[model samples]
Target: MTQLTDTHLYREIHEQPAVLRRLLDKEEATAAALADLIHGRAIDHVVIAARGTSDNAGRYAQYVLGAMNGLSVGLAAPSLFSIYHRPPRFGNALVLGISQSGQSPDIVGVLAEARRQGALTAVLTNRPASPLADQGDVVIDLQAGEERAVAATKTYTAELAAIALISAALSDSAEQRQALAAMPDAVAATLSMNDAIAAAAPRYRYMSRCVVAGRGYNYATAFETALKLKEMTYTIVEPYSSADFLHGPLAMIETGFPVMIIAPAGVMAAEMAEFAHAVRGRQAEVIAISDAAEVLATARVPLRLPAPVPEWLSPITAIVPGQLLAMHLAHARDYDIDAPRGIHKVTETV
Candidate 1:
């Protein structure tokens, strides 16, 4: 029975309120150590590390900070702090470790080493009591609370928001702060599109697999979206560069295999459109998210954002539809969205 309460998948949509409530109290919910670091000042480059969804958020942060404030940002494998990829000695570097649970050995251990080398450290995590906190110079609590869904929906949004706040603080501009402040509403509005996305999910459910592609910020979302679909829907989804897809992956793309492209109206807009034509020749389905005119394709889905934003932050918007897609698919399959198989809220990878 598709009763409202029984729909485990829609719980993701319902949980939207919980995420919004937590975000509103940002200061109260924020981690003291992370806030202190921001106030302490004096930071050079920002370095980040994480494995899955967290890694995508880290990549988003780099784009936000670098494109918005023109700051130098770097992302490292947490193993960089150990032998082989040993941590670089730099007092000015700020290491940012992202782990929802805050206990992953790679993130925690590398953060400890970065601190030892005098690099400022910060964490994006949901667990305040996590040992990873002990190693951080600053800790930005994701405030995503307990994400029961193994596929990860809200935490990804929270972590990205936290990163934007941290980046805006570093940019130290009132304009940036205002932009960051407006994000909660932007996100809330984005989530409101759940119905539209739910309507679109069935169109691709018959397909065995699909692809998500983009460049820069949306590139990371492409990767994250693919990960979410596989984790939540038990479906095969691939993340690739649009250009790279044309060079190779496009060849294997048959009628049933669709392509989900995040075609942002950003720096690479023209090149992106050209790439879309290549996929067209393969007779593959193309679902593009963009503000420009929609292209005709086997399946063209146009995502409409309210207005233009900093190009780096555009992917932040691109991801909302993808999240809704994952949610709808889970519902369609009558699967438990709150607890997907073979995963957990915080995978403290052993």
Candidate 2:
């Protein structure tokens, strides 16, 4: 049996802090430059084109850019461009493409069309020279280096960081910059909980399916966490906003059913605590990833995030526990931590 520590996934999971620090150091200027270009343009909204984990990052951007920068943000439907050959007008929009490898044809095509229409375009990718990058007027390098794991660990967080950095740059808020600077430390602190997460993983070794819940910015965290669990442990995990879960999906919960809640301290805290209680009342086994005392108290397994992280930035640190949980759960189930059964590192869809 290969040691989990020897796996690419494990190494990359632990490499996140350094990767974030490197990204901030190297790409802050680029992010600022992109912000400057956006400011110079007549851009009014954002259209993001991505797939898989990158699409989840776009989810985060929808909230962050909309709330922070006052820009309406929408996720682009790449199939419309790549398959149907009918692309929408991107007038007065900042069209952004995000990919780890910058090789997805559909995503690249979206940016190409946006650029051809003279829309302002930007790309967040690890590869600055790949096809997707060629379509961007500005490129924000993720700086996560070469990720060998089929499931993205560092690049996902780096993408979130790049998005946050750009939003902060657009705002030119010193407080936001300070929060961004403190993110590496927050992530490092979150990484410290790995031992506890590892110890708790075996309890869920038989977990065949579950649901992940979050609200606000961590809504993206829930989706990304579900994706990681699905990829690494082959678990049937569904992600939902806390509001959405109550509307219908709450019916899926029975006694001892597993549900992971990503609830950090912020505006969403009270509502998440209420949702935690509601699910607990339904007799579901609550596995909470949160800094809130009430939510943690209600959890059968409380995966604590480092506290005092701003709500807007919480997704970056909150997802760490979920990644660790997936990795450790895969180890418990004796699954391949590096390569999941049916996926590759770069998936180019067109």
Best by lDDT: 2
Question: All candidates: CA RMSD in angstroms?
Answer: 3.2, 0.8
User: Candidate 2 residues 91-137, lDDT tens each?
Assistant: 99999999999998999999999989999999999999999999999
Worst 10 residues of 1 by lDDT: 291-300
Tens-digit lDDT track of model 1 for 1-350: 35434544456545654664575356333443454564466665787868798899977877777777566887776656554666667567678888888878877877888777877787778886898888876666777666655776677777777777766665566776676556656666666677777788887666568888887777788888898888878888889877777776777877645787776667776667777677767776778776645432323666665545666556666687787788677777776766778876666653
Query: Which regions of candidate 2 fall more than 4 Å away from where they truly are?
Result: none
Inter-residue clash pairs, candidate 1: 34-139
Question: For model 2, where is the 10-residue window of minimal lDDT?
Answer: 301-310
Q: Top model by TM-score, which number?
A: 2
lDDT values of the candidates? 0.70, 0.93
